[model samples]
Target: MENLFSHPESEPEPSQQDDDALEPFIITVVVPTNVSHAFQGFTDHPHLWWPLDQESVFGEGSHVEFEENLILETAEDGRTSVWGTIDDWQPPLSFHASWYPASTPLWSTEIRVSFRAVEEGTEVRLVHDGWEGAEDPAASRASYAEGWPRVLERYVRFMGGAVA
Candidate 1:
């Protein structure tokens, strides 16, 4: 899965890779922490950092676990729902996942996040691609472009990292 998202890898930062009708939305942020810590903020501490107001498969107060191999949510009653599959699970470096949220569960999109240690701290780059799966790719991309920044802002706050 990493191989699938490693294209245009020469760019240290975010690089756009246009493929057919889909264009990847790249969001890069600098966190004031080590690579390992930043990675943990995204994976291990998702419940603490991820914005919960958005559309979710398990709804609020659900026990959500975004693991290396799978993303799942469990209700209080023990009902479980799977949202995505983590294909590449490299720690402190990168990971790739196929995301299928509740709103549009019929299809999936590719999400890749890379963590790199920098002089200031860590660089977390997120790429959300595969918009072709959406019913309205352009609209969905537009919504995410506005939403991801806010979500990352919350993550930076939770990690005590500054977005540079």
Candidate 2:
């Protein structure tokens, strides 16, 4: 469940004029399953592993659903929120999306997740980019940098990893 690759520690500040200069936040983790199963576990059953009760737009008692073109999070109270839009979806391989959870699409970033076969299991690599759309890209990236590891820890545990 450890990252086999790492990026540079120092990253450039993102600006609307120079958005492409900012490097995407990349993280990789190996899951104890094949590519297809890992892909299904992430796209089809996020509600089971995602920390919906804690880090979600609807707060506690929310569940996620990946629709044809959207990722929806619905609360127990019946209110729903759009987390992202599926731009490109290729099962058992990779998918790209515009992510804007808890906000409008106008301020969306981008996410790409890929699943590849490895010696141990499937290597799930996540790349978060497109900071130009955010009002405060650096802050958003920093926040997610802190948050994604925890979220992926939950996912790794769900994927049968001995994650502590």
Clashing pairs in 2: none
TM for every model, in the order presented, reads 0.77, 0.85
Candidate 1 wrong stretches, greater than 4 Å = 1-21, 103-106
| Local accuracy of candidate 1 as per-residue lDDT tens digits, 1-164 | 46775668466753353342367899998888999999988888777766666645556777667854888766778987777889989987999888776644567787899999889789899999988877777677887788889878988888887555
- Give one clash count per candidate, in the order shown: 0, 0
Report model 2's TM-score to 2 decimal places.
0.85
* Residues forming the 10-long window of minimal summed lDDT in candidate 1: 13-22
RMSD of each: 10.7, 11.2
